[model samples]
Target: MTVNGWQVSGYTHLRELGSGASGRVVLATHDATGTPTAIKYLVGDVGADASFRNAFRGEAELLATIDDPNVARLYEYVESAQGAAIVMELVNGVSLRQMLRANGPTDPESALYVLKGSLLGLHAAHSRGVVHRDYKPENVLVTAEGTSKLADFGIAMPVGREAGSSVTGTPRYMAPEQWTGQAATPASDIYAATAVFYECLTGRPPFEGQGIIVLRDQHASAPIPTDPAPPPVHDLLRSGMAKRPEERPQPAAAFLDILEATAVAAYGPEWEERGRRRLAERAALLALLFPFNDPAGGGTAVAETVLTESSGFGGPGAGTAGLGAPRGRRLGGAQKALVGGGLVALLVAGGFGLSYASLEGDPVESSKDTDAPVVTDTPSAPVDPTTADPTPPLPPTPTSVPTATPPAPTASVGDTPTTPGRTPTPSRTPTRSPSPSPSTSPPPPPDVSPPKIGRSAASPTVIEPGTCPYGARSSTISATAEDDRTPVEKLRVRFTYTLNGATNTVSMFPSRSGVFHGVLGNLPYPKVITRIPVRVEALDAAGNVGAGTVIYVTLNNYCTPG
Candidate 1:
């Protein structure tokens, strides 16, 4: 009844597609146009909650902005006293996830086609200066016609906009910079695409490990593994997943050019047609599970196609098992897997090992361990879909935390949140260049004093209780950084904080004279009301760095008890 009654004005509910901690997704059709659509409904506590409502609206607005053949379109978002829901074009097909689970590795041409379609979708988003932060196998949907479309922009954000999330992507496909908690960029999307392509070429992701720490190290520092990919496409894999952003192709379209050339040369110009045929064959195998397909007796019910033992992306017991969630959960296998999208907090040790902590009713689990076809968004509330923003489903923190063990110590490398950019001038020779002319004047003694940085604090250190998984309200972070030689304007102050396992760094521009300020908002919600470890560092023109001592910021995550 909740599914049928949830408001989305002109759409008629056909069936419930999926449901999870975020909410329920239903298969619906337009009353006027008779076009099939997918409606994502946020109900119960989530519907009444302001934080979830805002995130849902935000994502809806994001979806409305792009119009691309390769990306699913947003029809509308609805909100009323009844509930909030997102209306989107219903692609009549199975998710690449389903296909991958049904069939092992696709042929080379098929993998190339997958990469091309995903890249084009990313190209459209990148044209708008947006980055699809979480691009993985599950996010790519393939229709019966063999066409692929990008799904789940729930975690996409504009370029250069950084959310201090623990880490906001599927680790198997995450870019190197994402592992270091850097903002998403066009290159980041390309890296993820290539990683997915690798998965299609081989049966598994390019880099696989037990946890995020190992994955993080591999993504950020390990050699880009090109050995697994077919020898011909090895170059694409290397360039796309390059450790540095600059090393990868510039925009999504630019990489698309490279992919086109590679495919044509390796598999001939008709490669896409062949690939699509292969993909269509794979989709045919799971035709019964497709939302548009109704079995002989009745409509498709989740129970009918409940993922069997070998069918789950995570194998068995991905959802409530291991996770200390309220035991006796009665959700079907598909429901459990689809609902397993919450992010588990990762504790980073000095040795790049994982240290997990216990969570309450709201647990965090690695999504890869419990992936499903559709990603139900985060828990959200009501909004006037006619005008409200969109949503971000649970910060793509797609898993519940594991055991009750103590979290590992905060990483000590907070002074610099990003990998050092380029080697420092390749080390100049000791034989210094001839003295500059009288006008140059010895470069003013090379600005020896690093900018002095003061302690940093976010105004309301406590995150709002209601912002469960999306993020905290915008809080202003202020710190003073001044250099004896460099003017206040010349000094750059960066505030770094490590929550869960990821490090978030914010650049504080000159607010006025001696002080620097930056607005901090939408931090991934903390599992416990503990302290977030942070520090402030400043850079001067001379490349000297000054840092403040590590400080603790209290997070009062006061919420309703179960």
Candidate 2:
């Protein structure tokens, strides 16, 4: 079956979201499971292009290997003699590009929040040796929940490998090495991310010109705009956009560290939460502008209606609307009816139109209203150092030992020389002695013990049921860790929970100081009892690892009887 002239057999096509140079994106639902998904297809002449086809397929393959909260998930890739299509998770949010255009520049805290998510996503790709060549605002999708995810891996390639001879990527955000025809590396990705970061701060790109050549030159030599940003952010922009690739942060993870430190120092400990809440508010406001019905269609009734009416496009009732017109002449009574029907379907079905065509230059369509509640700005209290556990120091280096001095040389004389001259006895050859061997220092003690995970607890072990928004149950998880031979470098908490019968996991960041503390907000679903299993991992400077005991928290909507 086909929906809107696109040949998709198992999935029912709802509407066209947008069209770009590569292909078109459409909203579709699976016939068997009834799952709503965004299908990107290489259509018409673009589908025939072998290179575009290969890239479309390549994007799906690359996405398959990545599974992170900050990156969009890929469901499946279908290819045929006619064209190619990629089925991916439909993020119900606005693009960062649109957000910037609508809201201008973001505050420092909000920008840092977005940057942190982007860097984590990029780090996931870099860990697998993949480089997102086209890292720009257009590819970042900010969901209604205030979570930012990286999208459009169409131009993504392996690290140290070139996509082709021709340079690819949005010129404004391209790195200096990319302009010079060098292979895309983690550093290059960092450069592009920083460019976006600059845009988030200044409401404009660092370098802009009339043509690609001028843009190239500007990126190669133009000084980064530090005047718009506060003093603390200047160093970040400078180091990320350094002219030489070697000077930039090698891997995205390294840059992420610097960004987090800067954010905390500038905005305080609760900076991330504040920024995310701001994004959530902005996203909610954006949703109000373009309201659409949910396409998932609660049951078979809505689904059947969409399928039956869409299939009747060219029937007797087809001419009743203006959809049957050959070209662009004029709409008659029947044409008007058809157009009206399609528009109604578009609105009711919540499918996107071609208005999202310009992916590179213009903003694209957002998803249906999530009805998620507005997150309030609640600053976290300052952590006390005296109560926190201290990190263990590394072992000392082995001391060196002095070598013994050689024995003093003794005088020697021949028997005949004594009678010839008294002076001859004085000139005796010094007896040779083997030089003492230098003492070798002992090897330093081996780092065998892993980091030690101390006590861990979650505040308010039980949450009241009926939270306004899914996943908004506010709580905090704190833990202490230590190492015998090295200082603790990082602490991470993984939360595993079941939402809508599917298991989902999210990684949470913890503060340093041999203690881990993070807030858990917004449960993924509403009015549902969820048991969240939490695990903590600590890593020392020497790479030793320690895992803490697992704990479970329950969300209950039921109240106990009096």
Candidate 3:
């Protein structure tokens, strides 16, 4: 099925995914059944090393024993004088590394779901007495359905892997014990899994550093980093990434129990479904990078602007991409755009609400998470435009409207000075007998009116190519809104927009001046001008909602920022 000197035998090659000095990985179809398979080859020096070949063969056999839905299946392992290759299931999805880069941080629900699937995969390996020593974001493949499959077990070793075995793993995700050259156990794998889970939730790994030694010291000494993630998972991170292996979750299933309970208590029962949907939407944004898109397409499984770790004990990065621990550059961060500390706005009366928190939509808000707000009136800088074109409701509230006579004419948004003076005459004429509430003195009918929103605008709708995902390249939405009973500052805003035929809900937080404002990013481009209809909705403290006008946003026909 292959030439004498071919890298792999018995499968036709479609394209190369990646390669290193040790070996190369390729997309191929099985000659017998034509099933898609990914074959990782060990060539030349490493392939011929007796120790490495034996290790590769042993792990391949261990992979064959794993039949869980979450772990990629190993089909066959072939060895010859030419080289050694392990054929595996070609996961038809992009890596988690790419997903975070394109869309930024995932919602809490989606992050939980991805972590759950990954833990399940790790559970399978752990149950079989195997440990995935390199469990980082790049090793987690997110399918179109948003489910994940753990891939690349090239460094996985059987439980109690000898201490003399070199300390090997992507340094960014290495466990404390791994840094100390200690034997790897299921708990070590759990530590790496937790670090990756943190990245999914907060858009960055727990620890990243410049060199392997710096990372090693941090892993051995740094307190677990979890504040950036939703609070519900803070305990989970602490338990899994505990500095000492004994302090971490013993088995992968034990961690799942804690994860499932926490997710339900914090996000409700439908959390997984909602999370998967959010993940699916974000993954779809990178459909072109999927290996199955075109077997012949020169596409790499990475985002347009690669995301990398800044500096921590364990961060996911550009290193150790393909299978095998080949001494890759495990320290380079992916340069992913940061998705925090941006402003937000809210939708008001008559329409749905939209508040901008971070560029990844609104800051994921939760009752337990008071640090970042979704739409509630959090005290921040003013964001709404005060482009003074007088609104229609102002003519009625003129300063000269207080009539001279004892006319208790109520002050309303639509009351004019001229009408207030005339209405006093009519009420007195009919009140010779004095009407219904003479004794009760009803405290002027309760404010039943909802808030009003006007002058909505989307600044710089037509953004230039290659300038986006940063300053001056993205669009900002601003609108004027006010309430009858609730202070305008207290109203919550939410904005909804359709992307790829699916409606996505975002937030528009208010500034200190009570104006709803938000910035819109993460939309794909390089196509002709398109019209996007954004829905607006607002909520006041009194539980009243009002409709707002739809705003249209456009994009350039061609050019995408790299």
Please provide, for model 3 over 443-529, each residue's C-alpha lDDT reduced to its tens digit, 9 standing for 90 to 100.
777667887887787654544333342212345566767887776656777677775678987677654345566656546664566
Which residues of candidate 3, in runs, are more than 4 Å off? Answer: 1-4, 20-22, 43-48, 156-165, 291-562
Query: How many residue pairs clash in model 2?
Result: 14
What TM-score would every model get versus the actual structure?
0.50, 0.52, 0.54
549: Cα error in model 1, Å: 71
Q: Is candidate 2 or candidate 3 better by TM-score?
A: 3
Tell me the number of clashing residue pairs for each predicted model.
25, 14, 52
Instruction: Give the Cα error of residue 12 in candidate 1, in Å.
Output: 2.5
Candidate numbers sorted by TM-score from highest down: 3, 2, 1
lDDT of 1 by residue, 77-165 (tens): 55555555565554545566545533446779999999999989998887776577778776787765678888766533222223444
Evaluated at residue 169, the lDDT of candidate 3 is 71
What are the C-alpha RMSDs, in order, of all predicted structures?
A: 27.5, 25.5, 21.6
Per-residue lDDT of 1-562 in model 2, one digit per residue for the tens?
A: 3523445455678766655555567766655445455666655554565665555555555666676878765555554455556655545566776566544567789888998999999999888767778788878877666778887665432222233445666777889888766667888888988989888876668876867777877888878878878788999999999999899876888888998899889889999988897786555434433323443432322223232444332222222122113211111121122223221122211232112212332212332221111111111233333335566688899886645974443455543553454454354666789898887988888877787777777654554332332111344555777777654443333444454566655444444233455544445344666676766666565566677787776766553221
For candidate 2, the TM-score is: 0.52
